[model samples]
Target: MSQPPPPPPNQPPTPPQGGFGAPQDPPPQGGFGAPPPPPPGGFGAPTPPPGQPPAYGYPQAPQPPQTPPPGQPEGYGYPQAPQPPQTPPPGQPQGYGFPQAPGQPGPYPGQVPGQQPYGYGYPGAPVQQPAPPQGGGRKLSTQMQIIIAAAVAVVLIIAGGVWFAMGEDGGKGADAKGTTGTTGGGGKGGGGGGGTAADGPGKEKAPANTASKVAFQKPHPKVTYLTNVVGSWVTDKAYVKTGINSIVAYDLDKGTELWTIPLPGQVCAASRHTEGNRTAIAFEPAKATPPKNFQPCSEVGAIDLSTGKLLWSKSVTGGQGGDDKARFNEVTVGAGTVAAGGTDGGAAWDLATGKERWKPQVNAEQCYDMGYGGGAGLVAARKCGPYDQQYVIIQNLDPATGAPLSQFKMPTGVEYASVVSTKPLVVAADVGDSAGDGSGISDFFSIDEKTGKLKAKIAVDADRFAAECDVTEVESCIKVAVGNGRIYLPTEDHEGSGEYGQTNEIVSFELATGKPTSDKSDAGDRYSMFPLRMDGGNILAYKEPPYDKGGQIVSIDGATMKQTVLMENPGVESVRRAESSFSVGHSEMLFSGGRLFISEMMISEPSDSGVDDDQFYMIGYTTN
Candidate 1:
């Protein structure tokens, strides 16, 4: 039998009911609870446990001077005199010393009362919710109820195949070079180069055909679990692993580091290989001590993976064409190509030489406006105009040179859309915002692959469907996934007000006719479910709320529009983005060796405002 687990450091001598030693009481369920009613000693009180020697194990938190109440040295916890508000004078940064706005006054409108401000300020603000249900019972709008119902129905759908892993027996493929298990022309995806000839990091020791089970990986792992180590100057021995300090190849069974290969700089984006076998990694050497102006070091290093040699390194600074800052959105890897875009413009490079393949002029100010999705090479982009203007332009690029192979321009404006290269088409959903009364109209458009011509168009009752999901703002339900002869879009009602109305519902349309794919569910909207990819003629979504079920992967049958919960996230919350924010910070999921691999991040409450939390973990797992 296993021995009792050792007590965690700093935990109370008596173990809490939960193995984690979390507070016995559940977290405050709603809005913030009134600040803990001053500590037992009263305001400006001493840290408690009245009889014990000062809780020495825990670090002492700095406290304000004791409050003297009603002529007494210290009585009630309330302050004797109101202290000045904690804020920097005018432009100065408070405490943390970063140039930014003060806390409390929210950056966006409609923050919940008593709740911490969201965004760059407070990290985990309570999720916005509508007013309590009406009447004797909570009268959840039909949409919200459907969302909850869908979640419940999904929980019932969890069964066999939920533990299935993709490419379990290994994938079969032959590239132009007649190499088995290789993808493109040169035995690698991009023009960058091929991985070291040495068997992949886990090639030999990891069994020949079967996929590794989640339980097989070591516990508490780093984020970068498997690297496709490819680049110039790399030796045949180079390998990649999930280990943090060591990205080197190791013997699969013995776990020995094969060779030491350094990255371009500290705090860098993950390295990627282009379809042509070219590898790219951006290095910000000067990030340690930022210069007065936030000019990112423009050094972008590209290396050939096959021969392990650096091919080109460029410093993209302010130039008429794409540069580092503007070009820093995504470096997409596709059929025989790799690309990136810049503010006011974008440029595509020849995967082989890092030479400019194509460049386009875009709105500069709007492109680089301290948000994400600006750069080119993103699978797709939604065009928005200056200052609240919502018009859109979607374009597909030429693989060899990132030129607009096709473009879709809308007369009014489209909120969001999805583009699939395999389908060679772009589908956009547009809904005119309501002036009042909280409802809107929806329109769908399909553009030709070669030219931006509208191949087909259809009208949709967006407000009706959106009402099902009381969605507010842009990012709430803007995800679109294309596959299985259909397009799946997540949406919510467009009640102009910030609060009220948020629900979950997937709007599915036929690929050919642009017609509704499924009858609307009569119940409340589906909640906590986001559209994943369409596979095996089915759509996959997160069936349960992200909070309750960690690592729970679900699938939706494209034909029946039925839901299936595939796998439960083992104590892991899939990464989520805050509404209206830009930077597409990384989410851990990828396809490798014919299997689905995911990395889960373990985060904590920030110690203080403005300071980046240094603590996080990258746990790895296979879908099986």
Candidate 2:
């Protein structure tokens, strides 16, 4: 059996019960929970040099504090108090630190009131109801539910695929001189050099100090079962996000709606990579009426992020009534090609004109493409053989023909595979249900992009690692990141080097040798940090706040591993609870140009408190 589950952490964020499409119990999978606190004390902070200006919004480093400011953390590196700490009113968790604003005032607009919807969120937040029924999939019979709940009892991600590793040697990746993504060439979607961070750290400037006040909170769009809200993209002028049956873009600084592109149905899958401001996505072709709440997830298309335009959307209907629209579980784009794949079949289209590149080639019973990963390159994950004895093939495809230019076969027992990095050629898998906690990772396999050869195998213990991957989606993985020739993952929340609460650190493993590196960064006491993504060679991570503290965004140097605090959210009650409400692994986080933005992956239905008590969609913070 895998390591036993850790005790439920104190004061978890509660969003809604539904995570992906299923509900989980305490210590919910992908939750933002920290261990119980040992009272509150002064946690260490990064202090600036005596005369030099401090980074971001951090106040000047603390000098010898002659006296204490009520409610403020009285210690080294803390900002001098402007006002005494606000009383948290009654029953509310005490907000840490001092006076971003004075004494407690009226309810902030974002506050959810007495009760909130059940969330697969930070633990302990009050929930109004038992987990609600999700929109799709068959229900578990009472007997199966009881038996399953008692046994594995992990997050049930029916949305994505798993990665693979064979025997002890493991495997590698694929890349050829192919075309797709933001490149001018619109076919043959293969090759590396597509990772967004392949360039440099974002141009986000530091504020006066590492403190913040909420810039804005986006009102929630009511949706049932908290479904169909997926994908977020940032453009030069707007923050684009996927909504219920539409794609919406809002002005970055102002919460103004820039534009909305309505779709006939809900989005089923969206690519993480955007090429030349355009990205690929899969959605249902028709809206659910009544008798049916889910349409076939068959249409694939590309969206121009800047203009909020659906460049083109088409479905496979076979030449002449040969088959119905082909359904897809995932879609991705790179080298100017948009590829979609699933149990139904695989297909690719030109991003520029929506012209068909190729039809599904592996439809025969022997093998079929389960999904495709695109960004640095396009690779088809093909499944073959009978149920009891199955294997997988990771193939770099020729965009125009959907044929393999290079390939790597995976071992048996590969239930699912999450493509971690396309160009660096890395894949992750639980192998044989080894990570019993639903984290979807047991090992990481780094493959040579050019030769499709396995470089090294890096094993992980799920209970000790904090990354997560969808069990069914080909590309949905979170917390773990790759860049600077290494894979970075956060350790499970453990006893901190500090006097109290649990914390975790981000550790790296060199891709070349699959060995641990000397470089590491801490989440500080009572905080847990996860690599958000790569900024050039740097790792941009989010530090989940402690119960009373605020969240933080930090940038870690690729070489020295020195961490620079980018933004520190306000410890004001509403903002603290609001920031804590967003699960780092389950939400969209964008920190750029000196601003930090986070939004829920899905918005829950109304809580017992009423529609007015619904959660917020997006929250923005700036150093300014």
Candidate 3:
């Protein structure tokens, strides 16, 4: 179809730094300097027009332009002189587009008292005025102006030729819908819309192709800024990535941005409202940019949402105990306190006042997890050693201070996973086998958050070598969450021969009994791309297929499992899921209310020959 015209030619150009013109002196510092005098002419009036013969259907004389009352600026944002109005002959239409002269409506075709014809300019209509000259009438000299104009003309000619030579794809041209024109032709009305779904694994349904008709409607009664992003109902508004760093609050209906809290640097871990409506952001300086003494600086702070302010901040130096390359792995705020994990161990801080509560073990290089046990206390998991054959030490600290409540060890080694909790109970999972054979058998364990005691273990029969097959360890089951008397285990399956990985199958487990509740034998065994559970139900699954360039999300209901395809893209890249979203990675998928919040790391193409930088984004969906 004919494309819309290229942007207009007489578009006003953007001004320089001061932009058009600077304000006349910073807003009179304070008010009430002085009072002004009265108008020279008396207020009383009553001079009628001279009843003279009209010459050749023209009015007797032209009326001068009316100036605004004294004290107001000459024009809104412009200092141009206003033009005067012209007097038209009786019974003749006023100049076409412009309105009639002030205080006098054009003669109506035929109207009763107090009534007017449709589309007529009535009394009290705003006078139309031309806009001010742009760029202060061209600052260049006369010679420069001619040269610039000539150069611009030549450039446009060349550009037009190049655009035309590049053919219809490069410039405006008619498609099968209409005749070609130099630029934009009117759009053609169509009977149907286009639909697309990514061509990838899994059954994907195309999104609706219908367009909504817009109208001036009344506002919805329950609309509020927080409602769009707050999932307080059955699904609970869920977010996964370092939960503390970037806190996104949305207007429930449209998901508008309310505010964002910027950090000094990229964050390693974060948690939001583990205790109250406060967020805790923990970050370690990048390795190559470590602070003095080669120690990565870890910072934790609480954010106040209402005012978008940092309530408090604390710094921990040489106290963290993780991989020299690893960073702040965990940070949580609860019951007036905050805590973060380091290379050697973890540290706690007073939420209101940034005071060190107590210094715990120095596991600076070990993997760890932290969270508040509902209202019970603070809980954390620290790895005792390396992943292939390491142990995870669970600790419960006093909610008020960093006092140790209890410490215990899970039965299996650490493979870097999440610690899911159900108040009194927390579940943990990693890609490991009972014999530590590097087999892909999934290990699921539960712990008592209040006592840090081992509860139970469950094992899944995944392919023995599949767990170790991930070259970059990019895809795997990241976490195990417990709710409604069930546990959710998210896993991944990669099948393609591509550099960046993709997700295939996900599985769910009933960890309490240590058996596979999901039919993993089936290729369709879906898992959570992000942690998700509904009203604490047995259904725990989220699996994202490859992204297409511009596809639509569709819901899948397979006999027993229910899942939603969060994003749909058309190009292979758009459908491509980032490796950072899976297994021990910060990206977490969650479901709250009817909305699904999935955190995915976005990787841009390496700059010609440089490394790629990654950023996280939250995609949400509403089931209702």
Highest lDDT among the candidates is held by which one? 2
Output candidate 2 Cα RMSD.
Answer: 23.5
Cα displacement (angstroms), candidate 1, residue 207, comes to: 16
Which of 2 and 3 is ahead in lDDT?
2
User: What tens digits encode model 3's per-residue C-alpha lDDT throughout 134-234?
Assistant: 77565665445445444655565576555433332331211221111111101111111122211213323322431111111111122111111111111
TM-score of each: 0.45, 0.67, 0.44
| Best TM-score among the predictions, by candidate number | 2
Ranking by TM-score: 2, 1, 3
Cα lDDT of model 2 by residue, 388-449, tens digit: 77788788777767867778776666767878888888888888887898888888888876
User: Residue 377 error for model 3, in Å?
Assistant: 4.9
Error of 1 at 555 (Å): 4.4
Full-model lDDT for every candidate: 0.37, 0.67, 0.39
lDDT of 3 at 260: 57
1 versus 2: better TM-score goes to: 2
